[model samples]
Target: MWVDLVVEEILREAPSHRHVVNDAKTPSGHIHVGALRGVLLHDCVTRGLRDAGADVEYIYGFDDYDPMDDLPVYLPRDYERYLGVPFCNVPAPEGGGESYARYYAQEFIDVFTRLGATPGVYWTSDLYRSGRFNEAIRIALDRAQEIREIDREIRGSRGLEGRYPLHVICQQCGRIGTTAVVAWDGREVEYECRPDLVRWAQGCGHRGRTAPFDGHAKLPYRVEWAAKWFVLGVTVEGAGKDHFTRGGTHDVASAFCTRIFGARVPHPIPYEFFLYGGKKMSSSRAVGAFARDLAEAMRPELLRFLMVRPHPRKQIDFDPAGDTIPRLYDEYDRAAEAAQGEAEDRDLARTFYFSRVAGDPPRGFRPRFSKVAFLIQMPTVDARRVLERDKGAPYTAEDERELEQRISDARRWLERFALPPARFTLQAELPEAARALTDAQRQFLRRLAEIVQAEAWEGEPLHTRIHELKEEMGLTPREAFGAIYLIVLGKDSGPQAGWFLATLDREFVMRRLREASAAPASAGE
Candidate 1:
């Protein structure tokens, strides 16, 4: 629904409905999951435009021509020498023939591709080397003074008084980050590679004059950002909110777009950050989960739902260590139900529609993710059979596939990120904590053991009986459930106690309950 509103705005503002929606990233390291937010956001707008009968071309660029200014902590210390070199020129970490940028960039490309975002992929290095940016580079060089004035006016920056708006790769050291273009002649530029120019990389102090076109030089990012809009004909683009700040890079770039490049500024779609555990993620710093890993660990639709469900301006704070994954799956299922006309919420239906990678939302028995998670952890339980029974029908082929995918996702979550209480292992012997239970709690467990042994009980019926016994014994929910969990799981809480106990071996349940109930109560109790 937000995407539809954005599409309406873009269509109303642009007389020419044809648009190029673009997003790009510099692959300095393993791209974090946070970067996927921009990619998916752009993709959503692209799809929205197309659905609204506007011609749209979505382009994703890898800004590999950018220099590596910092060594990622995961890399060997010796990689420090590679800092300041253009990423396209550095060797891949695995010693393959691919450039360092392509190696990491391809890894991220695979992730977005899996999410069904197949944009026109391009490399910034190729654009430069192929002379696509030659004209823009010349424009920047010719208007260097004006560009300087714009930066000064907008950002109050005074550092570019004498320096031009370009940097050349040092002829001697091959490092781009430390070189500065001092003068731009009609055909050639004078530059210097100063050793002390930056703290991250040492320069060779090389000086040379060369043509500043055709990959020999690069415009500073602010100018390049505007140049990209001009060269690629991008009409719609968005960046993180930080860039759209007052007097920020986007402001300076917008000024350049209107003044220096003589091009209309692209429609802006400013978005918020995708935080992990409340902290913003970084690509080079290894601060959050890598995009590819998260993609693999989640169902494709569920991952898409996680990205597109929230408004672009709203921050998504995800912590897989808790119930985040299960809850997300639950929400995604609800949206799917709405999409299937099972609910009257149009917004939820729209969310489910856009979250889909392909085809109509499947219609069938959909189990709750939390239940699926619980069932998978029980070694003796047949999760598929249990779910089929709960559905009151045999699983259709589609239902089977869906259950299998959720099972895989649930197991991965359990292995990597599930919280302690969500994880379970039936105690081989009576847990020592059972001795701390109150007498009334033990009495409740003893009654539960009798009910479990009296006759065969399914998950729901057993669950109801557990609640009845808790009331009969005058025990609180915490005490009643705590007694069962303490004996079986050695924890204070777990999945629904009835369903959990019913899934276990009836003999083991009776035996653990007997042992726990018969144990002497703690002194305080």
Candidate 2:
């Protein structure tokens, strides 16, 4: 519903021509997961507009002509020599068939495809090579003074008066940023590749005069962003919150669009960036969690849900270092339940629809994932029965399939990401710790054996009995549960002992408890 509001507003001021939703990124290296947010956001808007009977297209642009400004940590130090070279023209980091830009771009694209953001992809290099940007290029060159004046008036910066707005890829080294255009004759430009022009890479220091066509030169970022809007007719786009800040990229690009290219700027969807490990994600892959890292850690649908569930303005402080994936699953299932029935919480209901991967989401009496997570590790607790009871309805085939998938996910997630406190295996024998139990602790297990055999099935009633036993034995809940956990799990604590015992093959639980109570209480003492 919120996405509809965002989309309707876009269609309200929708382009008279083809409705286009566009986003751009330069694949300097392994892209941070933060980048996927824009892909999913635009995808949501695209789906919403199509549902409303508006024709729309989503395209992701790769600014492949942009120079490699920094060496990603994953690449060798010798690769730093390629810095300041046009990314599309540079060789892949490992010397693959794909150019350097395409190599990283393909990796990132595969990641978003897994997360379900499949936008039509375009390369900015192709635009320049095809001469599609020539008109905009000539306009920017001819009206350079106008842009200079606007910059001076708006931000009080000295403008590009004598110099051209384009950076020519060097004739020798093929580096873009190190070249400076000193003169523009309206049809061609004369440039000098000064060795000291940039700190990143040394220029060949060659002076050359050439026609700026067929990807020989590219517009500066501010001009390029504006030119793409008119050339490609992008109707809606978004920028990270940093870009939308005071006098940032969005401000400069928007102004350049109106002043130089004379094009309407795309509708802006400004979003906050994701922080990794409490630090702002750096473009450098060494700093933040990457798209592939998170994609493999959990189901992609949950990751996509994370992207769309939050308002664009809200900050998603996702640190999936511990039980965060389990918690995320819990939150997604909550939203999934809210998607069905009259969920008074509107955000919950709307997010589930946006979070789904394909087809209509299975509805009605959805199980709470947190509870299922706890129940799943219990070997004997009929997981389907626990899930069905939680769902309060018999599962259809689809529901059964969904449950099995989640069970596998929960198991994998616990073994991988969750902390030791949340993980366990049902024991085959009374654990070594069972021998150390005091007489009173052994008596507690004996009493729990009776409770388990009485068919006082858990989860709720079993959970209640543990407290009753605590009161009856004059023992702390910790002491009482510790005895049971040691007997079954070889630990001082584990999942709720009562539900756990009831879920076990009743014979296994009864036998384990009997073995534990039969052990010499003073053996370890």
Best by the lDDT measure? 1
Worst 10 residues of 1 by lDDT: 356-365
Task: Give Cα-based local distance difference scores for all models.
Answer: 0.88, 0.81
Misplaced by over 4 Å in model 2 are 14-18, 155-162, 342-345, 362-376, 379-395, 435-440, 514-525
Name the TM-score of candidate 1: 0.94
What tens digits encode model 1's per-residue C-alpha lDDT throughout 109-219? Answer: 999888878899999998899999999999998999999999999999986778899889999999998998899877999999989877888889989999988999888
Whole-model lDDT for model 1 versus the true structure? 0.88
TM-scores vs. true structure, each candidate: 0.94, 0.91
Query: Global CA lDDT of candidate 2, please?
Result: 0.81
Candidate 1 error regions (>4 Å): 362-364, 428-437, 453-456, 505-516, 519-525
